[model samples]
Target: MSHRPRTAEAIWQAADLPARRLAGVALNPTAGTDVLLGLLACDSAAVRMTLCRDRDLPEEVVNAVLTHPDHRTRSFFAANPHIDPAQRARLVDDAHWLVRARLAQGPGFSHGRSELPEHTVVRILTTYDREHLDTLYRQVPRSARWTFPSHPEPKVRAFACDWWSELTPRERSALLADPDEEVREHALRNGRDLDPEYVERVLPDRACHARTHLLMHGALSRRVVEQVLAAPVGREDLAMIAGNPSLPLDVLALLARDPDPQVRETVAGRPELTAEQRRALATDTDSAVRTRISVHPALTEEERAAIDYRVSSDETFGRFDIPARMYDPARSRHYALSGHPLLRRRAAHDPGLPPDLVARLSCDADPGVRVLLAQNHPQAPAELLLDSFLAYTGRERWSLTTRPNFPTEDLAGYAGAADPMVRRLALLSPQTPPGTVAQLSADPDPDVRADAARHPRLSPRRLVELLDDEELAHEAAANPALPPPVLDRLVAALDG
Candidate 1:
């Protein structure tokens, strides 16, 4: 067999080692644009990595890589220092944490650099992190150290306390007396080496959540607890101490008999309470505390079930966690017909709700409940969707139009609706017939015309006509209907 030099495309797809290595290393800007585009789609990670560093790579090319299915590739694109801040912001909510992490390194709002303003640095650090925290800590401005101790996340606050000596006396005192209980708890645990002077100042403050946090830390002295109880403090503060697991039996007994019902309620829910304590609380005059004791784990299973039951409803729904059992066929039906509007509203939104219940709620007297049925009931009757369309406006109307499996044929009239947004969405529907798209191609609203220009069914000549329109050209370029010859001419025009 006669040997001839293989073309770049042949080597780009070659099975041989030397040929593929040459393909990646030798690839450069001078290569044909189509060849570069083809190589950009190569299966090899090495080739992709090599292409990202090319000096002549255009911003348009980098933006195109953002849509690559491989997260690593998208992340590489995001980490490019030159990546536009606006482009980088698009990846912040990406599903993969690594992609967001890469975007964080860019110049925009990630506080990625050490040189950003201190307030901006402090604001960005409030969100939790794993990899970025330690690196960011060394770079954090000394002036910004005061704010982290009261940060919403306990871990971040704890991290800040690791360098406690750097904070001023006022900062230390403020952290100790912080209103958020978790921040105070972290301070007591992590600020052990700090001067006791701050603690002395925090101890005298009447309303600080720090007292209960100190109780949690086993650092509260008997004298301090006594002083707090005697201080003419509000019952809410007393209730917090009453709930403390490490509280002494003597103080617990005193609080158990406290005149305040909230204090009694707090003590009733204490996990460390003995069976004897629970039994004592069971007889309390407060019915709410009695109910708490019935369900308390300190009572035996039989004892818990033995309590006198009431048919009346609890004003505050317990937990409201909406467990899986709430979705059971029988339970959902019961809730759907209940007199309580909230229960009926919840049932109206339940996906597994019985079809008959869906029909009932569709015409619910409460418009909010009816809207819930309209949004969530997948099997909603056509008349209900139509009525929902006519009955609602603004977001509710827009929301109804976007429902999955929406009969697009029903949207045909909306193409000319008074609301331009409604008309745009109607025109964008996959089921919008060809004739409607053709008609909207000349829509007076530029936005509607832009959407029509990008429609996959748009004719090739119409796409060519949009080529010179800067607003629609990019979208028109993305239309797969454009012929290769047209793409050649478009590229030629751009180069000229």
Candidate 2:
């Protein structure tokens, strides 16, 4: 046999190794980009890790490989810190899990649950490992120690707040270093809101932190956030501070060019944002910036149309987080008409359904669309909600039963209805009352009995009086809230 190597197999094999391992040991500095790119282009996902490791690669070449149609190519870019915000934003909604997983690491990404993909969140919180969290936030000091008091998500900042007090000054500066106004505000808030000395701890350029803390606690002059915004020295830092509801218009303009779409979003999200701000963000080159404008309920159709213009390309849509817009009744209808399935899915999630649209969509061909409307309390018609419950039966018992908002009383009545799932939801409805739980205790389905048996609000004494059944007795005892006196009665019943 000839000694010539199989290039394709070699490329594919190279892609199977861990990205860090591939990036480590420098696979021979003398090797050509062709070998590197060939492995990057391989069928294996492992290539992404290696491509991210190459710091010496040219920017255009890196961008080209990043922008490659394959998701793995983009994954490499997300892992590469050198990729800028605009380019990094390109991977925000990449089709492959690994690509988005990689993107989650970049410094500016994943600020809120609103932007987080569901699977990624599941992976981050439930994966039983901090690898993904660490991968995305390796550069961020104590990624779990997110500080910066003004952050819109209170819990994350609070956790960070507790962590911040424990850190050195360099760590404190990282908390305020981001261009976010909330980050500044949080740092200003440092141990105490009223103390000026606490405010002195923030980095000088992002003095909006200290200023915002003072103004928030009513310790400083009016328009302190605005004053910071107008300062030429920290205009970028101040616009974020000015993002506070209390900041004036001129101050917000100073933050207008902030590289972060989220800052722009914060400005757009404010119902009171001015016409000039709307125009600027609506025309922003980034679709996310434009999506922020598009999702706003206050925008005129003409203004929204301008945003629609920027959204023509699929690339632009990836940068958009349309679900935020879908909650708006007016914009949701617009999204429902969009060509994208995901946007339509979001629109379908809106609680408000016009009577005619509601009627038409009750039989929507898409199961997810039908299911979403069933879940929406505001727009979903009562009849549709009921129909949706009845329509779901043996399909998946847990899905219908788990919804916290299903109409319990009405569902209880529907126990006599066709669908077992409907009957189950009806029985479990919070409003099912003691009367309904009693009735369903002896129902034919074990699952239904189990649900009632386990309900914390239901009295185990009621369970004994009602169930007169064996398995139900064990479940009723499990509830710690069940009065101990009830256990005595349960034991008496067993004795009988």
Candidate 3:
């Protein structure tokens, strides 16, 4: 006979998440407080919100509901005017949450009055959460706008940046100069384009600002970028200028002499440069600069070989994750191979490729490339991965193997593979049979043996019997789901 669930209100009542979700579609406002309390106090959120709507709930019940840790219940009690204003203000700091808020303000608004008549504005300003940005779109100056730019939270300062149109230009300038970098960056990244005068003033004067840093480093606007290039001040300042995509042919020639290969490489990649500029970069003292010319989309394959390749640049930080916003084909091109192996390692996992490109990368002799490939290629073929696993496991080693999904048939053969990394991986797979897991537990590799000992199919008695195997028992104990008494007995067995 099929088993029936007991305790209709217990955990078993809902067989799955969907059933749990459907259990409280509607709430009874007039329901007795007993049922209301049971639902509101439950771990099940559906039951809590449903019970919070009881209109006839006793004032004490409503008041107690406000103290609940759940945001929705506190929000409900906040809307219920029955809660006293003084009590609501106190709730703002309520270890739970402040339930009382402004209801008298026009449609779609809620403001909590401060204790002091005049200081309410300050209180409202202090309470704002900038991430919930839409909430501030319509509130009045006294209610939602914070006049200060130095708020402790940059997100709140970011919110203040949106109110630029309403503030005086001086106030806007003050925000641009705000000490918080994210506040300045967010303002420029999203707000209306800054006037050229403001842009110039901000870039040089606000040199410490992160947006200015990005602007000097990778600015897109032509006129603004040219100005930074003309004012070559320092290596860092020069790096910022050359990094801009708007560099001209004449400017690229000047920058190609930069002591930093990183700076010269940026100039070499610009399409705006003439053929002479490209040809000049081909022989530029820095190997990285020449590499840029060879790999540039505009270069012909014939040009790549004709230009003598020299290795000059030793860039350590050239590799980075593929930018999510890299729509330009040039942004994704990889021409300069870095000497630093770590840089090449990160580049291997970047999801920047079509499947074919990743497959081509698999042939890369760098073991780190192989490892990164196994770790990150979202579309990595199972066949290629199985072969790699078989090859590595046959060596019987433990190491920095990137997690790769292997085929089922290959997993059985891998149990005997010499590499513990490969053997441990096989034991870890969900598809491995209980018998296979048990068999692998007795393998020579301590790691593979440990995983087998901790396998869910292993009985507590069996686990207790294996207490003499220190590493296996220790690994099994790390599984918190294992019974405390069983674990305690096993640990005690160490000495016994």
Residue 33 of model 3 has an lDDT of 53
Tens-digit lDDT string for candidate 2 (1-496): 4243234245445542223223321232433465455545544444444455334455555666766887545665665544444455455556666666565665344222223333333334333233545543332333244333334453344325444546677756655564656555666556454343443333244445544444434322333443454563543444345345545556567556677666676666566767777788788877666776676657655656556433331111111212333467776677666444335556666555466655655566655555565654345555555555555433432443334444445455765655455556765566667767766666788877766765655655675443334445434544443565554443333224
Count backbone overlaps in model 2.
11
lDDT of each: 0.59, 0.51, 0.51
lDDT of 3: 0.51
lDDT of 1 at 252: 86
RMSD of each: 16.8, 23.6, 16.0
**Candidate 1 residue-wise lDDT, 95-150, digit = tens:** 66666665555433322232334443444455526564444453355555666766
Top TM-score hit: 3
The regions of model 3 sitting more than 4 angstroms off are 1-128, 131-195, 204-233, 246-249, 305-379, 386-405, 408-423, 429-450, 453-496
Clashes of each: 0, 11, 8
lDDT of 3 at 278: 81
lDDT of 3 by residue, 1-496 (tens): 4243223245423333322221221132223355446545656543443344323355666667767866555654433333344443334443422232321111242222212222332344456443322443433344344444546655556766766656677767766777878788766754434444454545553456655455654434556656556664445665666756544556667877767788878777776767877887888887767766765557666777676564322222112333334433333235214333333454565655566557765766655555455545656566656555544432222322333444444355567667676677666555676677778878887778877776665555565555444345434443433555654443332233
Candidate 1: residue 183 lDDT (0-100): 65
Model 2: C-alpha RMSD to truth?
A: 23.6
